[model samples]
Target chain A: AAGVIQSPRHLIKEKRETATLKCYPIPRHDTVYWYQQGPGQDPQFLISFYEKMQSDKGSIPDRFSAQQFSDYHSELNMSSLELGDSALYFCASSPRGSGRFGYTFGSGTRLTVV
Target chain B: QKEVEQDPGPLSVPEGAIVSLNCTYSNSAFQYFMWYRQYSRKGPELLMYTYSSGNKEDGRFTAQVDKSSKYISLFIRDSQPSDSATYLCAMSVPRNTGNQFYFGTGTSLTVIP
Candidate 1:
C-alpha cells in the first residue's frame, strides 16, 4: 500500500522568511489534509483539499496557505513566518470525503523558525 | 470552550499492564471518534475509529464511545514496550462540504521493559 510522503523532512528558517512544504498523498486517495503539531501537543488541523480546490481552513492564520495540485499531491506554504510557526507539519490522505476510514498521515516536516 | 479536551500525560506503566486513554468533547455535533498512535519523530497511525455510541474491539485494543457523556476511550491490553508512544483522540462532525476533525493534546505513554 502506498503511504503519504512529505519532502524536506527538516527545515530551518529565520523569522519573516517564507517556507513551503510538500506532500504526496497515497495513490487513489482523493482528499488531502495538513496539520500542525506543536512540541508536546497533538496535531492541529490546518487545511483540507478536495477536487483540486481548497475545502476548509482551520484556525490557522492567513499567513498559512495550501494547495492541491491533483488528487495525490498537496503543498503548504507559510509566509512571513514567526517563531511560533516552528512545529511539525503533517500531511494526511483519505479515500473519500466522509469519515469512514481514518486518515493516513505522513511522517511530517519539522519546521524551525529561528 | 475547546471542542476537545485531553490530558497530556507522560504516563509510565510496566510491560503487560493495561492502559486506558480518554478524551472529552464539548461538541454535540461530533459523530465520529478516533484514536491514533504516534511514535517519536513519526506521523500518527490510526488505531481505532468509532461512530457515535457503542464499543469496538480489535485484538488487544478496544474503543468505546458514550455519546450521552460526550466521552471516548481507548483501552490497550497486554501493553508492550513497543506500545510506548503518544495517543491522540480526534473527532469530527458531519458537514455539508467535508468532515473537519478536532484533536486533543495527546497523552504520551512509556511502557517500561
Candidate 2:
C-alpha cells in the first residue's frame, strides 16, 4: 500500500528565511492534515484540507499558509521563520476525511531554524 | 483544562512484563478512540482503535474505552524490547465536527531485556 509522502526529509533555514514543505497523500485519499511536533511535545495540529478545500484549522501561525491542489497534494509555506518554528512536520491522510478510521502519517520533515 | 491528559513517561519495564498506559479526556462527543505507537524520529503507527465503549484486542495489544468515565487505556502483554516506543492515545468524533483528532502528550515506554 502507498503511504503518505513528505518531501525534504530534512530542512535547514535561517531566521527570517522562507521555506516550502510538500506532502503527497496516499493515492485516492482526499484529505490531508499537517502537524508540527516540537521536541518533548506531542504533535500539534496545524491545518487540514478536504478535496482541495481548507476544511479545518489549528495552531498554525499567521506566517504560514497551506493549500491543497486539485491533485490532492498539499504544501505548507512558511515565511519570516523563527527559531521556535524548528520541529518535525508531519502530514497525515485518511480516505474518508475522518480520522475515526485511523490516519496514515508520513515519515516527517525535520526543519531546523537557526 | 486540556481536552485530553496523559502521563508523559519514559516508563521502563522489564522484558515480557505486562504494561498499561492510559489517557483521560473531557469531551463527551469523542466516540472514536485510537492508540498509536511512534518510534523515535518516525511517524506514529496505529496500534489499535475502538469505538464508543468496551474492549478490542489484537495479538498482544488490547484497547479499552470507558465512555462513562471519559478514559481509555492500552495494555500490552508479554512485551518485547521491540515494543519500546512512545504510545499516544487519540480520539475524535465521527459525527458533527469530526475532522479533528485530539492527542495525548504520549507515554514513552522502554522494554529492557
Candidate 3:
C-alpha cells in the first residue's frame, strides 16, 4: 500500500530564511495533518486540512502557513525561520470517515536551522 | 493537567521478557485509542489500535483499553531487540469536522539480547 510521502528527508537552513515542505498523502486519503517533534519530545500538532480546506489549527507559529491543493497534496511554508523551528516535521494522512486508526504517517523531514 | 499522561521510561529488559507500556487520559470522550512505535529520527509506526474498551491482540502485541478508568495499555510478549523503540499512546474523539489526536510522552524501551 502507498504511504504518505514527505519531501526533503533532511533540510538545512539559516535563521531568517524561508523554506517550503511538501507532502503527498496516500491515494484517496482526504485528510492531511502536520506535526513537529523536537528532540525527546512528543509530536506537536501544527495544523490540518480536510479536503483542501483548513480544518484545524494547533500550535503552529504565525510565520508558518500551509494549504492543501486540489490534488489532495499539501505544502507547509515557513518564513523567517528560527532556531527553535528545527525539528522533525511529519505528515500523516487518513481516509475520511475511516476513524482515527486510519492515520498513516510519512518518514518525516528533519529540519535543521542554524 | 495534560490531556494524556505516560511515563517516559527508558526501560531496559532482556529478550523474551514481557514489556508493558501504559497511558492515562483525562478525556472521557476519546473513543479510539492507538499505539505507535517510533524508531530514532523516524516517523511513528502504528502498532495497535482499539475502539471503546476490551482487548485486541496481534502476533506478539496486545492492546487493552479501560474506558471506565480512562487508561490504555500495550503489552509486547517475548520481546526482542528489534522491538526496542519509543512507544507513544494516542487517543482521539470522532468529530464531523476533523479529529485531533492527543499523544502521550513516549516511553523508550530497549530489549537486550
Top model number, DockQ: 1
Docking class of 3: medium
Pitting candidate 1 against candidate 3, the one with the higher TM-score is 3
Tens digits of lDDT, candidate 2, B29-100: 887899999999998998888886888999999999999999999999999999999999988765443457
Candidate 1 residue pairs in clash (backbone atoms < 3 Å): none
Give the local distance difference test score of model 2. Answer: 0.91
Can you write out model 2's per-residue Cα lDDT over A83-104, one digit (the tens) per residue? Answer: 9999999999988645675799
Write one digit per residue (lDDT tens) for candidate 3, span A8-31: 999999999999999999999999
What docking class should model 1 receive?
A: medium
Worst 10 residues of 3 chain B by lDDT: B91-100
Candidate 1 per-residue lDDT, tens place, B1-113, comes to 77899989979999999999989999999888999999999999999898859999999999999999999999999999999999999998877668888899999999999
Estimate the TM-score for candidate 3: 0.97
Candidates in order have lDDT scores of: 0.90, 0.91, 0.93
Q: Per candidate, chain B TM-score?
A: 0.97, 0.95, 0.98
Could you arrange the candidates by TM-score from highest to lowest?
3, 2, 1
Model 3 chain A lowest lDDT segment of ten: A95-104
Instruction: State the displacement of the C-alpha of residue B90, model 2, in Å, after optimal TM-score superposition.
Output: 0.4
Which pairs of residues collide in candidate 2? none
Instruction: Please tell me the TM-score of chain A for candidate 3.
Output: 0.97
